[model samples]
Target: MPIHIKADMAASVWKVLVEPGDQVAENQQLVILESMKMEIPVVSFSAGVVITVVASEGSSVLEGDVLVTLSDDGETG
Candidate 1:
Protein backbone atom coordinates (compact mmCIF):
# COMPACT_ATOMS: atom_id res chain seq x y z
CA MET A 1 0.00 0.00 0.00
CA PRO A 2 1.06 3.55 -0.63
CA ILE A 3 0.70 6.08 2.16
CA HIS A 4 0.45 9.79 1.78
CA ILE A 5 1.47 11.63 4.89
CA LYS A 6 -0.04 15.05 5.25
CA ALA A 7 0.22 17.99 7.55
CA ASP A 8 -2.52 18.24 10.13
CA MET A 9 -2.35 22.04 10.40
CA ALA A 10 -1.01 25.13 8.69
CA ALA A 11 2.60 25.79 9.50
CA SER A 12 6.08 26.44 8.16
CA VAL A 13 8.20 23.41 7.58
CA TRP A 14 11.01 23.50 10.08
CA LYS A 15 12.82 20.41 8.92
CA VAL A 16 12.53 17.36 6.72
CA LEU A 17 14.14 14.34 8.28
CA VAL A 18 13.58 11.78 5.53
CA GLU A 19 14.22 11.67 1.81
CA PRO A 20 13.22 9.44 -1.02
CA GLY A 21 14.51 5.87 -0.56
CA ASP A 22 14.81 6.25 3.19
CA GLN A 23 13.36 3.39 5.18
CA VAL A 24 11.22 4.45 8.11
CA ALA A 25 9.50 2.77 10.98
CA GLU A 26 6.07 3.28 12.40
CA ASN A 27 5.81 6.49 14.39
CA GLN A 28 9.10 7.71 12.95
CA GLN A 29 9.34 11.46 12.70
CA LEU A 30 9.45 12.56 9.08
CA VAL A 31 9.10 16.32 9.23
CA ILE A 32 8.79 19.12 11.74
CA LEU A 33 6.41 22.02 11.38
CA GLU A 34 6.67 25.31 13.16
CA SER A 35 3.47 27.12 14.07
CA MET A 36 2.94 29.77 16.71
CA LYS A 37 6.54 29.35 17.76
CA MET A 38 6.07 25.67 18.47
CA GLU A 39 7.66 22.71 16.77
CA ILE A 40 5.31 19.96 15.67
CA PRO A 41 6.60 16.60 14.61
CA VAL A 42 5.04 14.72 11.72
CA VAL A 43 5.31 10.99 12.06
CA SER A 44 4.72 7.97 9.88
CA PHE A 45 1.70 5.80 10.72
CA SER A 46 3.38 2.61 9.52
CA ALA A 47 6.71 1.24 8.40
CA GLY A 48 7.53 2.02 4.80
CA VAL A 49 10.11 3.14 2.29
CA VAL A 50 9.93 6.84 1.53
CA ILE A 51 9.10 7.41 -2.10
CA THR A 52 8.95 11.17 -2.21
CA VAL A 53 9.38 14.19 0.02
CA VAL A 54 7.00 16.96 -0.94
CA ALA A 55 7.64 19.39 1.86
CA SER A 56 10.86 21.35 1.95
CA GLU A 57 12.52 23.00 4.89
CA GLY A 58 11.43 26.62 5.37
CA SER A 59 8.40 26.16 3.16
CA SER A 60 4.90 27.05 4.30
CA VAL A 61 2.30 24.33 4.18
CA LEU A 62 -1.43 24.15 4.75
CA GLU A 63 -3.63 21.68 6.49
CA GLY A 64 -3.93 18.39 4.63
CA ASP A 65 -0.88 19.16 2.50
CA VAL A 66 1.18 16.14 1.64
CA LEU A 67 4.59 16.05 3.26
CA VAL A 68 5.80 12.66 2.25
CA THR A 69 4.84 9.56 0.27
CA LEU A 70 5.65 6.03 1.35
CA SER A 71 5.43 2.54 -0.09
CA ASP A 72 4.69 -0.09 2.51
CA ASP A 73 5.94 -2.94 0.39
CA GLY A 74 9.33 -1.27 -0.16
CA GLU A 75 8.82 -0.84 -3.84
CA THR A 76 8.81 2.67 -5.31
CA GLY A 77 9.16 1.85 -8.96
Candidate 2:
Protein backbone atom coordinates (compact mmCIF):
# COMPACT_ATOMS: atom_id res chain seq x y z
CA MET A 1 0.00 0.00 0.00
CA PRO A 2 0.91 3.62 -0.35
CA ILE A 3 0.37 6.66 1.79
CA HIS A 4 -0.49 10.00 0.26
CA ILE A 5 0.45 13.25 1.93
CA LYS A 6 -1.89 16.11 1.13
CA ALA A 7 -1.80 19.81 1.73
CA ASP A 8 -3.97 21.00 4.55
CA MET A 9 -4.57 24.44 3.05
CA ALA A 10 -3.97 26.42 -0.12
CA ALA A 11 -0.47 27.85 -0.22
CA SER A 12 2.73 28.26 -2.17
CA VAL A 13 5.34 25.59 -1.65
CA TRP A 14 8.22 27.18 0.17
CA LYS A 15 10.50 24.16 0.02
CA VAL A 16 10.61 20.41 -0.37
CA LEU A 17 12.49 18.79 2.49
CA VAL A 18 12.69 15.27 1.09
CA GLU A 19 13.39 13.72 -2.27
CA PRO A 20 12.21 10.57 -3.95
CA GLY A 21 13.60 7.44 -2.17
CA ASP A 22 14.27 9.42 1.02
CA GLN A 23 13.22 7.68 4.20
CA VAL A 24 10.82 9.67 6.35
CA ALA A 25 9.36 9.06 9.76
CA GLU A 26 5.81 9.58 10.79
CA ASN A 27 5.08 13.26 11.39
CA GLN A 28 8.31 14.29 9.68
CA GLN A 29 8.16 17.57 7.80
CA LEU A 30 7.90 16.87 4.10
CA VAL A 31 7.23 20.22 2.52
CA ILE A 32 7.05 23.78 3.75
CA LEU A 33 4.22 26.03 2.65
CA GLU A 34 4.01 29.78 2.87
CA SER A 35 0.62 31.31 3.43
CA MET A 36 -0.55 34.49 5.17
CA LYS A 37 3.11 35.37 5.72
CA MET A 38 3.59 32.27 7.81
CA GLU A 39 5.44 29.01 7.12
CA ILE A 40 3.58 25.77 7.55
CA PRO A 41 5.24 22.35 7.60
CA VAL A 42 3.43 19.64 5.77
CA VAL A 43 4.02 16.41 7.69
CA SER A 44 4.14 12.78 6.71
CA PHE A 45 1.44 10.56 8.16
CA SER A 46 3.39 7.33 7.76
CA ALA A 47 6.98 6.23 8.23
CA GLY A 48 8.32 5.01 4.92
CA VAL A 49 10.34 5.77 1.84
CA VAL A 50 9.10 8.69 -0.27
CA ILE A 51 8.06 7.31 -3.62
CA THR A 52 7.02 10.46 -5.38
CA VAL A 53 6.50 14.19 -4.96
CA VAL A 54 3.55 15.61 -6.85
CA ALA A 55 4.39 19.27 -6.34
CA SER A 56 7.52 21.34 -6.64
CA GLU A 57 9.00 24.34 -4.92
CA GLY A 58 7.30 27.69 -5.59
CA SER A 59 4.17 25.87 -6.76
CA SER A 60 0.72 26.62 -5.41
CA VAL A 61 -1.19 23.72 -3.90
CA LEU A 62 -4.75 23.57 -2.71
CA GLU A 63 -6.20 21.71 0.22
CA GLY A 64 -6.53 17.98 -0.39
CA ASP A 65 -3.91 18.10 -3.16
CA VAL A 66 -1.43 15.23 -3.13
CA LEU A 67 2.04 16.30 -2.18
CA VAL A 68 3.97 13.06 -1.82
CA THR A 69 3.49 9.32 -1.67
CA LEU A 70 5.08 6.84 0.76
CA SER A 71 5.29 3.09 0.89
CA ASP A 72 3.41 1.51 3.78
CA ASP A 73 6.55 -0.20 5.17
CA GLY A 74 4.55 -2.29 7.61
CA GLU A 75 4.14 0.64 9.96
CA THR A 76 0.40 0.38 9.83
CA GLY A 77 -2.23 -1.91 8.37
Candidate 3:
Protein backbone atom coordinates (compact mmCIF):
# COMPACT_ATOMS: atom_id res chain seq x y z
CA MET A 1 0.00 0.00 0.00
CA PRO A 2 1.02 3.59 -0.53
CA ILE A 3 1.14 5.88 2.47
CA HIS A 4 0.89 9.60 2.02
CA ILE A 5 2.39 11.77 4.68
CA LYS A 6 0.43 15.01 4.67
CA ALA A 7 0.65 18.35 6.35
CA ASP A 8 -1.54 18.78 9.37
CA MET A 9 -1.79 22.54 8.95
CA ALA A 10 -1.07 25.20 6.37
CA ALA A 11 2.52 26.30 6.54
CA SER A 12 5.65 27.07 4.61
CA VAL A 13 7.99 24.22 4.04
CA TRP A 14 11.02 24.95 6.17
CA LYS A 15 13.07 21.94 5.25
CA VAL A 16 12.93 18.61 3.52
CA LEU A 17 14.83 15.87 5.30
CA VAL A 18 14.11 12.95 3.06
CA GLU A 19 14.20 12.26 -0.67
CA PRO A 20 12.80 9.67 -2.99
CA GLY A 21 14.28 6.16 -2.49
CA ASP A 22 15.24 6.89 1.08
CA GLN A 23 14.50 4.25 3.69
CA VAL A 24 12.31 5.56 6.42
CA ALA A 25 11.39 4.25 9.81
CA GLU A 26 8.27 4.85 11.80
CA ASN A 27 8.19 8.34 13.28
CA GLN A 28 11.13 9.51 11.14
CA GLN A 29 11.09 13.20 10.37
CA LEU A 30 10.33 13.83 6.73
CA VAL A 31 9.93 17.57 6.57
CA ILE A 32 9.60 20.67 8.70
CA LEU A 33 6.97 23.34 8.24
CA GLU A 34 7.24 26.82 9.63
CA SER A 35 4.10 28.71 10.50
CA MET A 36 3.60 31.59 12.91
CA LYS A 37 7.27 31.39 13.83
CA MET A 38 6.85 27.84 14.99
CA GLU A 39 8.48 24.88 13.29
CA ILE A 40 6.38 21.76 12.98
CA PRO A 41 7.97 18.45 12.10
CA VAL A 42 6.24 16.04 9.77
CA VAL A 43 6.97 12.41 10.52
CA SER A 44 6.29 9.07 8.97
CA PHE A 45 3.58 7.07 10.68
CA SER A 46 4.82 3.76 9.35
CA ALA A 47 8.11 2.22 8.27
CA GLY A 48 8.52 2.32 4.54
CA VAL A 49 10.65 3.42 1.64
CA VAL A 50 10.11 6.91 0.29
CA ILE A 51 8.73 6.75 -3.22
CA THR A 52 8.33 10.44 -3.83
CA VAL A 53 8.71 13.80 -2.15
CA VAL A 54 5.93 16.15 -3.19
CA ALA A 55 6.92 19.03 -0.96
CA SER A 56 10.03 21.08 -1.45
CA GLU A 57 12.05 23.24 0.84
CA GLY A 58 10.98 26.88 0.99
CA SER A 59 7.63 26.07 -0.56
CA SER A 60 4.17 26.80 0.76
CA VAL A 61 1.81 23.96 1.48
CA LEU A 62 -1.76 23.70 2.63
CA GLU A 63 -3.39 21.39 5.07
CA GLY A 64 -3.78 17.80 3.91
CA ASP A 65 -1.22 18.27 1.15
CA VAL A 66 0.91 15.26 0.46
CA LEU A 67 4.52 15.80 1.45
CA VAL A 68 5.89 12.35 0.96
CA THR A 69 4.78 9.08 -0.55
CA LEU A 70 5.97 5.77 0.81
CA SER A 71 5.45 2.13 0.12
CA ASP A 72 5.70 -0.79 2.50
CA ASP A 73 8.92 -2.12 1.06
CA GLY A 74 10.36 0.33 -1.45
CA GLU A 75 8.11 -0.88 -4.24
CA THR A 76 5.15 1.22 -5.31
CA GLY A 77 4.12 -0.78 -8.34
Candidates 1 and 3, the one with greater TM-score = 1
> Tell me, what's the RMSD of every candidate?
0.6, 3.1, 1.0
Residue-by-residue lDDT tens digits, candidate 2, 1-77: 88899999999999999988888988999999999999999998778988888979999999999998888774322
TM-score of predicted structure 3: 0.95
Maximum-TM-score candidate = 1
Q: How well does candidate 2 score on lDDT at residue 47?
A: 88
TM-score of each: 0.97, 0.91, 0.95
Q: What lDDT is reached at residue 73 by model 3? A: 67
Worst 10 residues of 1 by lDDT: 68-77
Off by over 4 Å in 2: 74-77
Candidate number achieving the greatest lDDT relative to the actual structure: 1
Mark the 10 consecutive residues where model 2 has the least summed lDDT.
Answer: 68-77
**Cα lDDT computed for each candidate against the true fold:** 0.97, 0.89, 0.93
lDDT of 1: 0.97
Q: Provide the clashing-pair count of each candidate structure.
A: 0, 0, 0
